[model samples]
Target: MGLGRGLAIGTLAVGLLVTSETPALAGNGPAYKDSWRPVKVRVADLLGRMSLDDKLGQMMQAERLGVKSPADVTTGRLGSLLSGGSSQPTPNTPVTWADMYDGFQKAALATPLGIPLVYGVDAVHGHNGVYGATVFPHNIGLGASRDPRLVQKIGRATAEEVSGTGIDWDFAPCLCVARNDRWGRTYESFGEVPQLATEMSTVITGLQGTRLDQPGSVMATAKHYVGDGGTTGGVNEGNTEISEQELRAVHLPPFKAAVDRGVGSVMISYSSWNGVKMHAGSYLINDVLKKELGFKGIVVSDYNGVDKIDGKTGFTPEEVEASINAGIDMVMVPYNWQTFIDTLRTLVQQGRVPLSRIDDANRRILTKKFELGLFEHPLTDRRFLKTIGSKDHRDLALQAVRESQVLLKNDHHVLPLLKHGKIFVAGKNADDMGNQSGGWTVGWQGTSGPVIPGTTILQGIRSSSSKVTYAKDGTGIDQSYDVAVAVVGETPYAETKGDRPQGMGLDDTDLATLQKLKDSGVPTVVVLVSGRPLDIAAQVGDWAGLVESWLPGSEGAGVADVLFGDYNPTGKLPVTWMRSAGQQPINVGDGRPALFPFGYGLHYSRHW
Candidate 1:
């Protein structure tokens, strides 16, 4: 019998004979149901059995909040679901996340074909969407460490935490080579050089494990496909006006590295390449990425990415047709996914979209599901639940924090503060976990105050020494203190809201806070907690020491370790520090004078 006919008979038999603990099918079932078959062979078998609705459903991904009910997953046969950065279940614990994931997976399995649903999340920076999960230092910090091995370890730890929550896919290891400090998402980039981003792609291996089906392994995504960080004026989602050579040189290497590492998915950029929307750029998506780069993985649209194809608010039939034909395998239509399903169906029936394209998309997506072992193990693996925010992961994060600190200035050997001295700490970031963690934390844009469990920088300092005093605005700090530390810089922000088109200096609050400490004349040290470099040259002359703590997540003790000489400062600048906002796009070879050059850093021994 044909695979479709066999699948029908097998489904009936599975319903009658298969128990919760048994295999999905018995001895004489369809080949797709077998766990020992090759992934491609199984995908082909499953594809042959799927109806047009099944194929269409596999191409659609909806937001968890917009899913309405489990009936939506069953009736719509939705293949995937995602939690936007802020979306989470009540209590937002790891167990709750696994419960939510299993609920969705159960609904997906209830469908006639019983195809497993693959849930995705932007677990960028350590399964960041869930509370109490280990939050590693953002990519910029990792880049500064120049340690690919460490990044790979972080990826493994992150996969364990995410797998514990029953999430099998991670949209992370952003390969964008950030060319400008003004870009809000600059911190997401490993560094300005393509080499750095390429080196950091080891995180992909860590996330995916040696094999896709390995325990604690999760699918990795190389994202914002090309040239998101090289936009003019560092505008978020703006056009990248560079030539093909420059694009390949500066922006494409990391993705090439990701593909080399066997990445499971590539997310198309929201930004354009020389006025051409990446979503609708058939030549680049189809010819270059798929054909030239040999990326056999799924090409997923960014969040609502297809809607902006025609520069319009919502997606259209033409946009859908163009995007799919342009090599997009999955469309992340978060809310109006039903409309997407219906529109694509109509387009296919009208001969606007070819059935071959649908089959191709399903083939790529199903291959991954098979490789993930979702057919046999479709529910949450409760074994990994204990790994979330575990002490071991926190220790790793602390080491990352210790290594990512870049000491930009140490005038007259002021750093490595004496352990028993009277030390005064003041600034907005000193005691704030939310501010130190930056964006993509428990919430979408991230919020201030103890949003999750982690040591504040102030707490780290107090734990290290008994003579630490803190004031939010530099109050009560006087000459009597042996040293004054001002932790200050940008607060939490992500993507569009993060771009700094104009001034990129310390705000009045931070400047005022520093001035108070500087005025006291007790050898003031400035510890900057920020995502990207701030324009601090104007006031550098007044500070005794300066340290760049690039949004060290959940481990304030690491920052304290460097401050108190427990760990020597070793992190180098990933991006060049601008002397002024006018030198916005300064890079390593650009030859423009920098306040602190790229790769510039100081050590206590060297400075002393």
Candidate 2:
């Protein structure tokens, strides 16, 4: 029977209340319900009892909107639910998230087999889906820190926040080894170097923790499996036209590192390798990733990734069959999930997809579920909910911001402005939290406004100085001010929308701000808040000091830490700073002239 509708799931920030109607004792259920047995034995026992419908459901991952009601999870025997980039529950609080998770999880447990659904979210830089969660620096900012241990700590903190809301999996640590900064997702990559991405795989350990069953630990996913960063023209989901050797050399190392750390899942990229869709690349997905790399974890598809197999508007039977056979264990059918379930079931029944393949997918998925201890404990661990935006997490985030501030130019040491002097702060980004946090923030292409809690650069400056003023357009500035700080550059963006199809110069607003500061005769310090380096060579010469702040999420105080010499500037560029926008895909060893080379950074005490 279908469950009741409008089940008044309230905010769980206070605490969760498991209804008295939950199922009977574990003694009544099969041996698979026993938590003490080895995961494989339990998996096998559970597999024997599951029907074809159950197995098909285990292979499908539906988005939150796709499920009509909580009962749909039980009736359909669905295995997973994901909240897409912008998808959040009503009230959008941590409490709401826990309630929503428990609601869906309760439905899954009502089935005959009572297999728990593994919920996933894109907690790339924290529990990014929830409001008031600690927003750490994006990967580019972390990469500049060159501290894998710190990255791992951030991962652990993120996992705790995610687990508090009952999410079991995170699609994170995008080990794409971004070869071109022009790609909009470059900020998501650790750096351009393979070793950098490889080293940062410590985050995998941090997310999964010492053991999968550990409290507050969530399964980690090393995503966009291979060659996504090497795409020509730095296009999102575009083809990587490189040879297999080049692909192996540049892109495969990070995935290897992730595998070594026992990451629970690997997401296949939407981009093609050598003009062949990764979704249908059987040799790569099955032969290489599964067999060669020995990635025993479930291989998940990107959002609607299988639909692009035939390069069509909708998926065909051929595409579904090919993708499954090619080794995609879980299809992220964000919508139209029932069609996927039916198509796969038809293929398996028709023998186009083998029973062995179906068993393999179920086995891999169930193993993770068992390893995650979902059956034994299927509710939110609310102890960590309070830790979402706790002061400790924000302090760590502040440290990350401090280490990510790359000093690009400091002509004659005009920085570290005296606390007693008159200072003027101006720019569209100076007092904006949304702009500092960049993309994958509260919303998907993150808008610039007071969207979340955090100190603005201007606020940081004011707190650090006795005399300071802010002007969004550099109004009321004179030589009377000891220094003019112009916090300007690119605003918030993500994915293809962030790609620079036009020239990469600063906007007119920023240019005007800089011009006013430059003409004021006060020593000018330009703090650029951007995801990637831009064309600033012409105007950079006019500034007395320049800092590449990247996207210092949630901690403008860290930027102030460097500006006041409380923390020395140590962040190096993670991507090459191009001389101009025309030099689109410039890199360190590419024989092109860069305004600042990769790994270039300076300190107040260092000789330029």
In order, the Cα lDDT scores of the candidates are 0.91, 0.88
lDDT tens readout by residue for model 2, 1-608? 11111011111211334355422212333547756445665677678777999999999899998899998899889999999988889898999999999999999999988999999999888888788998988999888999999999999999999988889999998998887777899889999989899999999999999999899899999989889988998899999999989999899999989998999999999999998999999999899899998999999999999999878888889999999999999999988989899998899889999999998999999999999999889999999888899999999999989999999888878877788888899999999989998888888888898878888888888899979988899999988898988999888898889877678889999998888888889899999998888899889889999999988888889999899888899998888899998887887788898999999999889432
The RMSD (Cα, Å) of candidate 2 is: 7.1
Error of 1 at 528 (Å): 0.5
Could you give candidate 1's per-residue lDDT for residues 1-608 as a string of tens digits? 45456545444533444344544433466768888545655676677779999999999999999889978999999999999999999999999999999999999999988999999999888989999999999999999998899999999999999999999999998999999888889999999999999999999999999988888999999998989999999998899999999999999989989999999999999999999999998988899899999999889999999999888898999999999989999999999999999999999999999999999999899989988989999999999999999999999999999999999988888889988899999999999999999999998898989998999999999998999999999998887999999999989999999999989999999989988888888898999999999988889899999999999999999999999899998999998888899988999998898888889898888432
Off by over 4 Å in 2: 1-29, 606-608
Clashing pairs in 2: 12-95, 13-95
Worst 10 residues of 1 by lDDT: 11-20
For every model shown, the clashing-pair count is: 0, 2
